[model samples]
Target: TQVTCRNSLKNPLWSLIEIPIISSVTCQTVTGLIFFQNDFCARILLLELKWCVLCLLLNEAELQQRSPPSMISLAGGSPNPNTFPFLSASIQVKNGRTVTFDEATMKRALQYSASNGIPELVTWMKNLQKNLHNPPTASYSPEKGQMDMCVTTGSQEGLCKVFEMLVNPGDNVLLDAPTYSGTLTALRPLGCNLINVPSDQHGMIPAALKKVLSRWDPSEVHKPDSTAPKILYTIPNGGNPTGASMTAERKKEVYELARLYDMLIIEDDPYYFLQFEKVQRWLTSSVSVPFPWAPTFLSMDVDGRIIRTDSFSKILSSGLRIGFVTGPKPLVDRVVLHIQASTMHTSSFTQLMVSQLLHSWGQEGFLQHIDRVIEFYRKQRDAMLSSADKWLKDVAEWHSPSAGMFLWMKLRGVADTQQLIVEKALEKEVLLVPGGVFMINSSDPCPYVRAAFSLSTPEQIDEAFKRLSLLIKDAL
Candidate 1:
């Protein structure tokens, strides 16, 4: 067995220490130490203090090589920035030699960043949050104990740090079944038994969650006690694969459940700004999402159980790898400690570029851009849905997504969708997510597939689904 924890000095007498625990077991190190319950596999001694810095700069080729083949070929949940001409204009770099290269925003980006994020970027995000929700004052700080924000490599890293801070080995975590797979991928290594909850067409069912929590028995071996869930992970806005957006009423109901149960709600809203046109129309008009925009759970939070993670990848560029988290200062402070120990900080260059772009755009410009992007996806979603209605209604069924890119199809009488895709669909050059991949347990049959129209063009979408329908027929 292996034991790991944050670094500390066990004894002051020695500059370095190596303590033999039992027969061959040992605890050793100067800067940090590892305790082993079994015989040492290997041992090394260093006399001089040496330091080295390593940086991994990944370009498109490196990213493609490192990322899973399935992920690279899919019309994923992120925007294709190459399709957006305006974003390219913002990314232009004539030179890093002088501050006056582009003469306007380029000069501002060369400067170092503020501790939390660029001050102006924080202000822009604050104001955008305010407009999204009609909240009081809309001022939240990265200091004090109430509210704060920390920039991260991406929401993946944010979730990793959050898990590091909150989850102890053997703890029980409540996650939405068919949830974001990345969250499962990151947390599984930490040794928590993820309890998957059932969701319907409306996203996470609060009633189902209540039942699960109520049924949890702490006294059972390998079970967590009744203290409360370590965290309640949710992606209320355009949930992954399913594309379900919680209604405002639903948000309130879930919020009440979270408060009553005393569980921290992690509102992962990477696709918050990417709602479908119909959903956008509803929100901008009379209908609103169950969760409030901007301050979100933090706004409704009375006891500080809401922590929201926002990502720039969906609407902006994923290569930038920028995201932020807002929540109670205590939790965020702990996260910052992890950040300090690991990343030191998110990419300063990327942060500066984002800060400069947002500052130039201002809140109103930013809102307009979000609206435009929403409109673009809205058209794509409608086209895909129309195609599915014509080609899939007799064989497969799907609810029209309220927001986000994917149109999740529950295939009738189809099992082993993953195998079907590998054997048949790829041969036809059409790629889609096999629903089982999204589950916490990938062993069982999920009879569902997620088709994204986000990255694909309107012209290609119909052909894609038509080919997919043929594959489904062949599989049957």
Candidate 2:
């Protein structure tokens, strides 16, 4: 007897062939007939076969998950939970004010929480972004292209996730020349075609960007078939390495170009609060004044094209690994998805700490804290600039940065600073980051070097510049 089966073959577990039963009387045939006659045995057989097929399918699906035991992984996303040992913490602020987290807050931090972040902390960040950037309009709904925020381990992590969400292999990415080395490190492995837009003292030059975009020739690129650059990655305020902040007018021009080119702008402005002019005035005068902040790309993002990443690393503590991304809800949602699958969320304890600090400070207090920080760094900037003027004025030229940490110097007569740094600067006990490392084409000759004054003492700044001057003169 033949049993008719309507096997669509769409499900791989089941076979399309029919089974025929015969009345022949062999021992094996008799056993088979008995098993076939029992519905339970037949069902068991089908289930076992399905299980075997499922195993095979799963094995085929995840080749990377089945990596050999000998394969060592350097690509880990989650930090070891053991490192965080604080059950509770208290921070003292100005005016004898102390903010402390109790057991309840500690418990919430120790245990798992929402993927987006701690809700209260997220609200604080959203308010901060709103007050700081004053984005032309706002929305929380992704469908409406409303702005939203997501907490990240750091701004660097947000940057990595953004690149992952937006860039495919061989996609074009626009970057300000002398870009952050960290940005290059995050994007290089993705195989992106990087186009460098030249920058001046006021960050990315809008006219240069316009010319590059208008005359963009795909044939000139290594990958002609790649899509046109849809993203511009910039460090708008006190740009890393270059230490050039975009003026409000420059930001407006760049924003217009982004609109004209239909591109998304990634504004990684970690040093926004560190702008110095108003802080200098407040420090010098007897009366305190509000800190003046430059207009951010987000302020001009009428079309929701700017994704701004900010960090506590510069303002607060670097070890906290706390930062936030503010942008259109859809893009932020993607970042949250990536976070959920990877680090899960930024540390709840860290978020709680930051939130408590902000709450105690209120808007005025927060502004005051940043003003003090800016004043501290402004002196350092002054020290570095003074040393440069005294020691190497004839040998090197640089624009005194209005914001951020580094002093970018163009060394006269040197073709590449990398060799000088390796052979001479280190030998002289003075160290600096070669400007070539920050260039889009690392092989290109760069006469520049970046000197950071954020951590060094005034004496160290003067001594380092003196040594660097000697090295430059020797090379010449």
Candidate 3:
């Protein structure tokens, strides 16, 4: 298919245009995620969506069982559950309790489920959001309003979808500095102009955001109509590498700046449940949840301007690769559409498994489990801090993590950690991530290094720091 314009010279404004102004448009159907094909540029995305129709049809197939009982699921290609070899399944938790699924339930688990998520699991997640953050928005309504929320293969996928949905070739995007390395990977290849906002121990600086926007002024972004820097991405809770959570006041101020600049906030909070200092308050029988961490941007998003990406990787199980995107109906539904086209849905079996466990635990038991998890990590943090104090106190300085698994350390004399950690530390049998990897400009020198306390034993942490101290001394 081709679109040929015969009267290009007839338009007077075409003579002054610098670039070729749509002289010929190749209007062809592209396979998979390539939006369209053109002669000048082919906007190729990383996601493979060529087999999307099969998944879309499967979604309808899965819905058949939920439909009228009089209807049979002949349209579905789902395998018969009775043919499955497994009879029943039981999973035991650390608390020494087994959640058993009987034959019927096991059969259901073996089958396909909804695209968004298992309905019960999605509901449970929504209730958890209400109990914890309690945004101004209500439930999911696909026909009337937003899809409310949808589960993704991982939180990063959900976040990436938003980036794909909003950003164009030359659009400007705002993000906190010394940010997550994963964030840079997600945004960089999109060809969008990346603007770094200065941050402190309290997270993204509001004054800095205002300053960035003041220069942008919508017009300077080279975007049409609305605001130029439309998306502001941040990791508000237990920031990656830095491990610094935002103060409530900072969140309020940031939200205000977003409102003023007409920007949407994307709060990527994977460590929301892992705050070390806060004691877990038990949720009562009525499914109410209370968290002592700083106010989430979602809580302050009265205008439905905040889209929060949360993960089960930290709190529940990392391998599950399950996470939910919560925000305004419009944006969230768009994400769902992407999910439908790509992964179709998060694994229905995993979704049902997690949902079952939560059902058995209830809200109170869930918080109790979180209490144990926090205690375990707090001990790990303390062990690492103690080790650092004994070995590297004079060589490096670090901020105590209030939550999560990382401690950000700035070497006293080292100018760049790249060669030191990657080359020297590897030889020393000590492994720690160099800080330059997390920076937006990877080639630049960075003095910082991230020390993780998640997996190392106390003795291991102590020995690693001792070797790190030696590495530092040798460098100095």
Candidate 4:
């Protein structure tokens, strides 16, 4: 074995590596040492999934660590975890089952973890990606069109960082209209120019998207055209505010358009697991994932151009603040660098807790849990629908949500919902978000209102819309 330097001189882009037995893979960098376990399993001799980050162009320094029997590891700046006062820990699940964290686990959780994440959790999520969305571009090579993922504080952080990494200050990015207010809040402050693409019940319309991008010739897209935006941001499945999922045809067309225009797509799909109630039969006891869940942009991604963020907040505990970013090696590497400099990786304990849950549940158990969640949300959505029909049928028009928690309601005979929702609805002891906040120009008058069905009871929902109908009448 050549010990280290396993093609370091020639393949400078491969900036990261993993253990011989350990199967976790993440893009560490192009400048740092390329460590390996022995000669490294060529199968697992992973590549640097390229990061589209602010280049940390280090001088070509040849660095690699390889195991030589029992070699003393003196590298890395992590503090000794043995010094921490906390020892064992445990938390009981909903069924009164305890998931204990022993000394070995506590040491890792209480102490500092790698910027990418704890290795076990990283491996688990990567495998989960394979199960959930067998992305076509799934590869470990440091070559172009490689996919990699990193856990984040929340999907929002991952989303925001990726947004920051791709969007230049003046670059006009294609953004979905009436998007998540949180998205508008996160992106608008960055000062990047946005080109709004209209969306209907089926999410972002391809026709509207094409019309906007038609400003510049499609042939010039693959070129380095400064004026043309190279990014299209969307939440295709169970989208926020709108609560709509893009049709399968639109998803295909959107991916093709992105290919044609050479544009990178950011798929912020937090509500993916919340799709309409449909039982997904598991083919295996452990891991035979044959697309039980709905298809994703990642599933169709052949060019490694999509950077998708999935959240645990909606399905699991929001306080846990755990999520993942999956996309091309280069762009994800930038997110890793940003995470290192920002929150210093998501809370290690939370990551471990999630990992522990997954380990105990296995893939089948985890998906069953998701099925329960989907059914719960479906009930909630139906309740809201029932209430809306009973109370506000004539006053508000809305499409039944395909997934997620929110209902987007357009009031009849109302020019804008701001004054009605803010002043009148509040006076009536009812609260709803005015749709203008989700707009690029939040100051403009908007006729729609967003209502969340996740928390309220059927009776309360009925009463709220009853009051809302009265308010709409008053406004008119």
Among these predicted structures, which one has the highest lDDT? 4
Instruction: For each candidate in turn, give its C-alpha RMSD to the true structure in angstroms.
Output: 13.1, 15.3, 8.4, 7.7
Q: Number of clashing residue pairs in every model?
A: 3, 1, 1, 9
lDDT of 2 by residue, 1-476 (tens): 33333332332222232333222112122211111111211321232233221111111112223568686645433344456575676778666888787766666566555556677788987887776667864743333346888889989999998887676666678999989999999999988789989999988999889888876553432232425577899998888998998888988998888766567799998988888865322322264556568778897777777888999898888999988888876467667766765787788777878888888887667777887889899999999999999999999999999999999999999999999997778888998999999988899999999999999999999999999999999999
Model 3 global lDDT (CA atoms, 0 to 1): 0.74
- Candidate 2 has which clashing residue pairs, if any? 139-146
Q: Sort by TM-score, best first: what order?
A: 4, 3, 2, 1
Question: What is the Cα-based lDDT of residue 326 in candidate 1?
Answer: 73
List the global CA lDDT of all models: 0.64, 0.74, 0.74, 0.75
lDDT at 444 for candidate 2?
A: 93
Backbone clash pairs for candidate 3 read 146-329
Question: Per-residue CA lDDT of candidate 1, range 1-476, in tens?
Answer: 23232222432211222332231112222232222111110111111011111112122322343468676433223244344333122355332222122433333344323335555566667555545653321343322234556777888788888777666556678888888888888889977789988897788888888798886443332222333464788888788989987776767877887655546688888888886533232234554443323235555765556677888998778998988877655456556656655765676567767776676666555666777778788888999999998788877989998888888898887976888776678889988889988998898988989999888887688888888888788777
Alpha-carbon shift of residue 200 in model 4 (angstroms): 0.5
Q: Which ten residues in a row have the lowest lDDT in candidate 4?
A: 57-66
lDDT of candidate 3 over 64-118, digit per residue (tens):
7568888755555678889999888888887787878799988877776777788
Q: Give the per-residue lDDT of model 4 (tens digit) for 1-476.
A: 12133433433333333222211122353334333221121211222222222334211110112245475545444577778999999899985557899999898787666666667888988888876677876864544436888999889999888876666566678888988878877877767787899999999999998888888887654343336777789998777899988987898898898877767789999898888845344444664443325678898987667899989999889999999999877567768877866787788899889988888888777877887888888888999999889888888899998888899989888888888888878888999999998898888978899999999888898888888887887777
